[model samples]
Target: MNNFKTESFDLNRAFLLDSSHPPSSIVTKLHPLNKIMAEGQIHEDIPLLVMELDNQAIAFITPQLAYQHIVQGVLNGQAWLVSFCSICNGGAVFSPLVDDEVYSFQEGGFYDAMVLLYDVQSGSYWDHLTGNCLYGSLVGKELKRLSNLLHMSLRQVLAAYPDALLALSALPEQQQTEAEEDEAWRKASEPEWSKGLVKTLGVEDNRLPRLNMGLGVWTETTRRYYPVAQLYAMNNVLIDMVDGQRLITYIDPLSGTPGAFFTDASQAEWQHNILQLNNGDSMRDMVIFDANMMLKRPQRPFQLFVRWYSFALKFPNCEIYGQPVNTQG
Candidate 1:
């Protein structure tokens, strides 16, 4: 409601030349197969096209449409703060309560997400070539498209979490037979609990790590001085924080309410949150702690998807090692 924007992805049908392909309904719904078919129409492979990049996927939807999504989805009700910590970079504590000029958290919203602009381009900490805006709308598309991408993006999965473990939730009780267990969920989610992780990771079957995210990404960095991600079979998708890596965690529940973006917050505050999430100097410190709730509502998950991807970009040489944990029947 703060401003308006738009883009479109209409599902169009295609008749395949191969009769061996499964029935149309099931074929179109299949992950790898469907993604391959959809790519020719979408103009690019959504998986590699979106996933190969770093920092918020940089969706190139129209600028106005992108900003509208930002305002409505997350900029509406959020609050923001900047760090003056000497660790990351000693600078301003600029808060909405303090200065209203250069750092306004009151009502004077930013003209653009960047500090400087030309005919229309803006300066950025990332994406120098594209001039992509950092607001959540333009960047945070991964979370929204996770389920779709997991199937379409790549045919193979590489489960490379630091602990070398996988937690597939939404499974069956031991009392049930193996065949019955797999059939019960029927691809609703990853196996509720998989046996291979315990055997392979050397973790006790009865033991699992408790959730302790006080350090945010710092603890994750301890294992490797960079971001880490491990792929699991769709049936092995997890709902809880898994081991030292909480792969599927969502934002604080309060931050996920509908219309959280700019709804109760002032325009200036909304814009401030956008900057902090995108490339504000203080954002670097955020990786050390939870920092403030940056996005308004649903985007917190999507935003993390981008940030994690960005972190990986920072480590181009990130060693990709680890034996693949098989999830097939």
Candidate 2:
């Protein structure tokens, strides 16, 4: 409901790369797949957070860049905070504009196994998943949600937008090197629960493993959890009725991230590794096409990737798909 006025804010100021700099200096014009093959910095299976702005694309290595950007406050109107926790596999993008003012954020700490961000303007800690102020004057207030963040692999991103200019940081080489090292360490570390390394008090959800990854969809009257393992076992596509609306869920084979969409009409099937439709057309990943091969925006649903245990704790009554139906004689 809040109309953001981004006209006054310069996109260049928010991102490290801008038009003033020579394209060859700051921009890396390469296909994501090629980049991954060349650098070997990250695996092809890991998902990346990419944003397309004004015909350019900025890709962030989720595990590394998420923490770096939040700690460095290297974001503006053009860049929002995209945070993902490897421990829980929870990812979200937070709008910088809060309460009519733009606030810079840094890593605050943790609460209930979730990251807490501290805003520079109000000095308040906010829950990373919910964006609600926890321990500041702004307590009880919530940060506005921005556009739906896309989680996909570099290859999938380049496939969707071939002309997207991959933006890299213009920072000094030493700082960048340190960030990369930190990210590498983070990626290798396993969750405490998974290794039985740490014991903490938390709600127990027996439906699935506490550390298992799942995609969560939250609405006013409904909360649903689609376990990624179940989705994969179901051939990576699951269609079900949610709150009187037919919802289609799938895991992108390229990125391994889960996504959901609401269809005006219930019509979806899989054929030849593509999601086929009754209209004589098909969909590959997030892009949708008609029978004549025209592009269209079918529907957008609120969804995020989170751990099953985290979701269970947040929404105790949430429904889990693929659960066995209790039958009594």
Candidate 3:
């Protein structure tokens, strides 16, 4: 297995995408929902990177983020950065403030087979998945993660908040046709399109296939990865302990993505795409509890719906949910 180290910063291998001759371009500004609604609207079923701020539900279209790689914006007076790496099939929402100073970002390059984002203000490179500054003036700094970020469909987002705002692109005629959107979704769903990225990886971890998708949950002290296949094998719902907290994790039926929440409920089951908590109440989607709740309620851990190789490399010590424990005989 390969591990990422802060000490291994090489300028030559940084894959500087912001330089004059770059591989691709990124979106510098984010647009409001109403402005782009006339050109085209995101399909309700299309997955988006979303978060709730100040009782307002905001979403970042993933297809656009896949092409642009990064989008920076100010929402509810908070500076946010929504990022997606098509190669790694990973996405996250982050606060762009480092040392309480706001910073914009551009695609820097690639490190450890993942996207490295550099702040336009300090030119410091950061790991897109973990938000940790790797090299430059803010080498040891970290971007604050918006813990409530979830990968949900526009439909699911709307269900949660009927008037949720969709974040769009400010670029003129940036909307893709239905065919183009389908192609982008297909490429993201299947990682076979990333053969070129495979060539750029420094090392390969063979424990799990490079394209296997899973949910990776982490806290300041520990991390764990739960393969989707194993979750399905266990009836699409399972309970596990991570970072000293009991968590109920499942493949969300509405969006076909994974979600985890801190719960004290002893038993849970997936019934008709809704999770039934043993305590008479149920969870609709992403911990929207109905009736009496048995969960800790407020402590939703930081989780990422990511690929196996991506999580395995970044968190080398992560526990695999179904992996057998080894003991000395």
TM-score for each predicted model, relative to the true structure: 0.20, 0.72, 0.83
| Residues 44-100 of candidate 1: C-alpha lDDT, one tens digit per residue | 222211111112221111111111111111112222221111111111111122122
Per-candidate clashes, comma-separated? 19, 0, 0
Candidate 3 stretches greater than 4 Å from native: 1-5, 19-40, 170-190, 193-196, 292-298, 325-329
User: Candidate 2 on 1-329: residue-level lDDT in tens?
Assistant: 21111112121222122223221111223344455446875566655666544445556556455445342222233435555554455655566677666676766545455555667677676666666665668876777665455677766666666554333434477866775655564444244342222222244566777667778886666678898888988888878887788788888765667888776546766675578766565678667777888876556556767767777756665678866542321
Worst 10 residues of 3 by lDDT: 19-28
Q: Each candidate: what lDDT?
A: 0.19, 0.59, 0.70
lDDT value, candidate 1, whole model = 0.19
Model 2: lDDT of residue 16? 23
lDDT of 2 at 209: 73
User: Which candidate tops lDDT?
Assistant: 3
lDDT of 1 at 2: 7
Which candidate achieves the best TM-score against the true structure?
Answer: 3
Per-model RMSD to reference: 23.0, 9.3, 4.4
Query: Taking the tens digit of each residue's C-alpha lDDT, what string does model 3 give over 97-148?
Result: 9888888787887776677787777767788877888788887787777745
